[model samples]
Target: MTAPSEPTDASAPSPGSPNGPGTLAWRNAVFAVFFISGLGLASWVARIPAVRDSLRLDTALVGVLIFGLSAGSVLGLVVAVRLLARFGAPRAMTISVATSSIGLVVVGAGATLLESAPVVFAGLAAVGLGMGSLDVMMNVEGAAAERAIRKTLMPLMHACFSLGTVVGALLGAAASALSVSVFWHLTAIAVLVFLIAVVAVRSIPELENTAETSAPGEPASTWRSRLRASLSVWADPGVLLIGAIVLGMTFAEGSANDWIALASVDGHGFSNTAGAIVFGVFVAAMTVGRVIGGPVIDRFGRVPVLRACAVIGVLGLLLFILAPNDFALYAGTVLWGVGASLGFPVGMSAAADDTRNSAARVSAVAMIGYFAFLVGPPVLGLLGQNWGILNALYLIVALMALAGLAAPAARERHRR
Candidate 1:
């Protein structure tokens, strides 16, 4: 396999320059990947209720099943870097997208045909593995695309993901209302998204070819050496700190992904359709926040912006859990969405502050952030089983507060 190329600096070729088409193509490509990833993941999330009912599962069983996705994601992280090294980001993305699409098909089949919880869990694991690798590749591509544009575009790229989620959630709601079979809904959506992704990936520039300049006579790092280097990044204090901050942020976000809809139905008395709408509202709010976050981060800096977001998240969660009326619940969902928007993307940008080791550092942060999903499903399951789904969300409030305290770790270090 060919050695991975180094990433170019942000100053290399601004997309606004006369030679803009190439840079713009890459940016659009990354956005497409982000959108597809979000859509596929949310499509599955929207069906969680249907799947649970089909399998006759309780809250605890639902949580255990969701753990399959998390476990797959963790495993994906281990394999993705190597794939990126051998095949490049675009190719790796193609492979991952295909994997997720197939996994979704399997999940749908299991739900509709077999009604087997284990089969569904296996499918979710497959989806998670693909999603995990896709997450890393897309972020790596987004960072490279941001550099090419010479702008703070991470939030915008993430916003595309939220936009996709909105679309997926709405579609999922429609599917549920129509009583569409899980197999048909997901399989059809997967096919449509896979086609779009195929077209989008064609535009990704060869990012691996732009490696940093090396000293005279220094050999390019082999795959084994690259793997070793990636593992070593975990030891860096800054990276670890960034990872910790992101852990809280991801926990907040992932919890919503897995639980918000269920909470609305179980805690509040909404039907599945209404529950999905609430989830959609949350994603829409996140989309708005991410759409507007770029300028805020550029002007105020990542640390301050993230801190404010954490505070808003805490307020949102409290209101969501304690609100006495549906109106207040809806209001809290909006606050929660907006508040949770910036953390993951900003943390990614912070981890990639030094472009030379961006791919590896990003891998490290993503692994840490994803751990939340790994632990979230089962933990929240038990909590919900004992207390209540809405009450279980209070755990995220504490996490958001911790995220605020860790915000300073994301400050860009000034090299003398």
Candidate 2:
């Protein structure tokens, strides 16, 4: 099959045109959103050990606690479409980001004051809810920006997320070493991220026209209509196939986020600070891969690039799992990062190929993709508790293989 056609500039106003400035602003704003989202989430991930220690939790309990985040995220996805419709991307993102920051502070407080697992779980659920909503809004904005600029940028935007995670992880490592309290560390980061989000969201352009809307004479959509509209996307084989591809890939990515640090600590006997640093390395590798992978995808097409990444990821996981020493572990982390890089962004792009149904389709695809997050941690936790954290990663290898099989779904359909 032929590669998808490059987007035409004809449909996009030039920088010299009146709409140009606003478009550029939105692009930058979306980038900031992606960055802060990654930062906030990573900040929480990086401090998992502290939280676990504070609660005196075992792997099984930790997994259950982590479930709260995913549960809240799923809840957010349920309402994100309506929220976007009512508030628009900028306002929605601002509210979501601020709320997520508050949740982070709460998490820190729970750890510091109460050392209560339930309280922490509740806070994390709040974080997840905000993050899930913010995630959809930012992607919607990213899709708009890509069309406006008439270029491929989704991967680069995701790279900004990885970069943010890198920064957050490094900060987390420092905080851990210095015996910085989780309460203070997370609280400070939350405040800073909230301030930045408030300023950045101002630049996001309106998204009322891009996604499908009600017919001219139709009454405003009811909750029933919106629910039906969302559920209907699952009936489309193409959209479902795209969702499947993303599901496996996101499992690979999210598994690393939730487990890699713990793996390094438990399996490799690394200190908590060292483990966080290793996670930072992983995020940094992912950032590099995404930065360079966009052009490769554009040139090679999505199918081949995705399949190749899956193969590489599998090898990385194996090496990390079976290797005898730190060298092999580090190498595996790099390969795994590269391998895990493309699937989610490419899947999002595929889902949004038709601008008319982009919002609904993207939401459907996100729900499937995020299912990995919801189910993966607890499953891996069980596996880790039964066998070992390192052994549990074999599951990711299997998932990556599944992702490769579904990569073809990401192939862009040639427009007639």
TM-score of each model, in listed order = 0.88, 0.89
- Ten contiguous residues with the weakest lDDT in model 1: 1-10
lDDT of 1 by residue, 1-416 (tens): 00112233323334455338877887888888888888998899888888887888889889999999989987876687678778876677789888889999999999999898888999999998898878767766776677667777766777888998999999999999999999999999889878988899888765544333221222566767667767888889888888878888888888888988998888988888888888889899989998998888879888889999999999999988887999999999999998988888788778877766876777688777777879998999889989888888988998889889988889976621
Highest-TM-score candidate: 2
Each prediction's whole-model lDDT (CA): 0.81, 0.81
- As for candidate 1, its clashing pairs are 5-208, 6-210, 6-211
Which ranges of candidate 1 are over 4 A from the true structure? 1-19, 88-90, 206-238, 354-361, 414-416
Task: Tell me the deviation in Å of residue 272 in model 2.
Answer: 0.3
Compute the lDDT of residue 308 as modeled in candidate 2: 96
Write model 2 residue lDDT over 188-235, tens digit each, in one string.
Answer: 999989999999988766655433344222346566775776687889
Residue 335 lDDT in model 1?
A: 92
